[model samples]
Target chain A: MTDWQAFFIALLQGATELFPVSSLGHAVVVPALLHWAFRQADPSFVPFLTLLHLGTATALVILYWRDWLGIVKGFVRGAVRGRIEAENERLAMLLLAGTIPGGLIGFLLERPLKALFATPRVAALFLILNGAILLTAEALRRRSERRDLSREEQEQQFKSAQQITFKAAFVTGGAQALALLPGISRSGVTICGGLLAGLRHQEAARFSFLLATPIIAAAGLLEVPQLFSQRGPLALYAAAAVVAGLAAYISARFLIRYFRAGRLDPYGWYCAAFGLLALILLR
Target chain B: METRGNPALAGVVAALGALFVIISALYAFGAVSFATSDPGAAHHYKHALVALAIAVACLVAANVVRPKAA
Candidate 1:
């Protein structure tokens, strides 16, 4: 691929990765639609994609540095003392629970699923289904009393990520599991699961962002060595990674604010329309 | 100003998605090509007619599902 193509892919990776839309779906469909030849079977493809994800994960870490600091401190202190801090223990465990399903599923089924639905046509179909998932989730009447909260109150409730039950995390993680599909989005499913579990949108969004960091890191770490072994342009890829990071960071900021009072319905429309176009044109 | 924010912004996004569909269609049908080295390069997209129709329906559904301001 050309430098500009790599840059464009990185930009899309950064933005869509966080936007509760399927970045994987975009990764598949966009190239096919543009008639850009990307060999998914090529050994280098996953590494290239992982580098872009590293950029995304970096953005998440930077954005939530304070939260990460607390989670780490609390985790380390508890590990040494054998008595986890009440809030940190709960939050950390919930994140662990939320990570489990996707991790297991990716480990076992990723190869098979990619073999079956990695094609742009199949990914596009799943993308439309993803739209339906977002809309249906949004349409469910919120059960939490936190509905109609102002921005500041919402922030307070966000701290209640500590209060998330293990069941909630498991279910949300189950949603993340579906993201092994090319068009299924990890953040979209987790956030939808979060909302259904009675967390407000911002809360769900925050947790989704948190949930993404480890998964992205693990995937990137596995493939980054391959990137160096390959003949790809290091400077161009680095520039693309930076572009991806910036795009993800900005998109996350916008989304955090938007979810304050905004609905996921617009994204639903977006996914449906784009997926339709994909289904029509792509094989 | 209708699209500076909020409900208007939502519609604008939907519209832009539709525009992309249109552009994609143009590319698929050889109405346009970005093959700079060979401008006349022809690209074939599967099911061009069906794609065109879906592109139109996408625009409709996008607007139909748009949330009203307020």
Candidate 2:
């Protein structure tokens, strides 16, 4: 791919990666819709995509440095004392619990699911379905008299990561696994799970991002090694990765803050509009 | 102007809008092609990269250039 092509994909990767609208869905559909000659089986494609994800994962890490730092401190302090700090222990456990369902399902179905990546029509249809899901989530949030509570009030309603039970994480993780489908968004589904579990939007968003970091990193770790095996100059890929990473970091920061203070209606509307347009144009 | 609470959110939306506008304009004026074909792949990739750079830069700038406190 040309440098310009790489850049656009990087930008798309960065922007869609964070948005509630599925980035993978767009990546799959956009190329196909544009009649790009990208072969899903191309040796370079998966690694290139992995690099893009690495960029995004790195961005998330940087953007949420404070949160991660706290988690690490909590973990280390708890470990040294031969006892887990209640908060840190719970946070770590929640993350692990959230990771499991998606990890197992993704591993078992990786090959079969990836084949679907080539078909943009399916992705488009799924995008429409995702739109429906988001609208449903908005409806649920609205109907529930869950007044926009203050942060402190919100805290009282939900337990911290450490306090979250295994059952809750498992459910959220199961929801996350659905993101394996191209248009089903990881954040959207997981956040929906969080909200349904009675966590406020902002809290759910925070957990979703935190949960995403490890999963995304694991995906990058698995795929990035392939780039090495193929034996290309790493510099260009590194530059692309860095560009993608920076974009992702900024995007993540924007999204976390956005979901915190804003209503979900705008995103729901956007998804509905985009999904409708895709169906009309593609079909 | 009430500039508290969701300024970051507004900035992101505005930035995304600008990107859509530029991309749409390029496609409309024959400056860029959105069709799916061999040449289109090259065009799409190149245009997408430029768009990505512009979008990323705009977002970063938004984060860095804070609005004056209301």
Candidate 3:
């Protein structure tokens, strides 16, 4: 890939990966829509993307280092004491439960999914579906809010990730697994799942980001050797990764604050419009 | 307050952990293959890490579920 292409792809990876938009979809479809020549099927592509994912994961880890530290301590403490009594321990276990479905599904079916639907056209179509999914989730959440629960009743709902049940986490993980599809967004679906599970937008976004770290890191960790292998331009790739990491860190910071009072409506509309535009242009 | 814990379930989870670690070893040794694309030594090592992580998680989970009072 050309240096500019690599840089642009890295920027796209960083920002969209955190945004409710599908980064993979953009990575796949944008090139085709713009008539960029690099083939997604090129042997070096997956490893390059994996490296970018690693960069984004690193950004997330840095952003949530305090939470991760607490989670690790709690996990160890829970294991030794044979009880998940603390909030940190519970959050750790919740993340474990939340990671399982996506990890397993990605491990087992990622290749097949890519083989079947990796085409830019298909990704574009799924992007529209992703938009619909996001809008529907917001509508449902609004409907639920209209129920007019008393202050005490609203206070009883899950306010933080730690307060959620394991079952909720498992189902949210299932939502994450849906991102295996080319155009689906991991953060989008997980935030929707969290919303359904009673978390407000900010907390849902926070939990979604946390749940994403391990999966992204694992994908990168598994392929680190390939990233350093002799076939690609290692120096250029490293530069792109740094770009991606910085973009992701900034995006995560922005999204955290935005979701505190913002809704998914704008992103949903953008996905729908972009998907439709890509569909027409690519055709 | 004392809470109920299932030791038997913990044992089962621990067994699963052992099985995954064994599978990880097999991958590391190149004793197994998946039906998809051709993989190199790095691929095998990568999968081995995945299995090892899973095994570790399971082992920890087993401990978390084991009866503390027993």
- DockQ for all models: 0.01, 0.01, 0.45
Docking class of 3: acceptable
Best-to-worst DockQ order: 3, 2, 1
Clashing pairs in model 2, backbone N/Cα/C closer than 3 A: A5-B45, A7-B49, A8-B48, A8-B49, A34-B36, A35-B36, A55-A245, A90-A161, A90-A162, A91-A162
Q: What TM-score, over all chains together, does every model reach? A: 0.75, 0.72, 0.90
Candidate with the greatest TM-score versus the true structure: 3
Q: At residue B42, what lDDT does model 1 achieve?
A: 77
Q: Which stretches of candidate 1 lie over 4 Å from their true place?
A: A80-84, A142-159, B1-70
Report candidate 3's fraction of native contacts.
0.38
Evaluated against the true structure, the overall lDDT of model 2 is 0.67
User: What's the count of clashing pairs in each model shown?
Assistant: 0, 10, 0
- Tell me the TM-score that candidate 1 gets on chain A alone: 0.92
Task: Indicate the worst ten consecutive residues by lDDT in candidate 3 chain B.
Answer: B34-43
Model 1: lDDT of residue A12 = 92
TM-score of candidate 2 versus the correct structure, residues matched by position: 0.72
By lDDT, the best candidate is: 3
lDDT of 3 by residue, A119-188 (tens): 9999999899999999999888777663576533542454778877777897998788788788899999
Q: Lowest-lDDT window of 10 residues in candidate 1 chain B?
A: B1-10
- Model 1 CAPRI quality: incorrect
The alpha-carbon deviation from the true structure for residue A16 of candidate 2, after best TM-score superposition, in angstroms, is 1.4
List runs of model 3 lying over 4 Å from the truth: A146-158, B1-16, B39-43
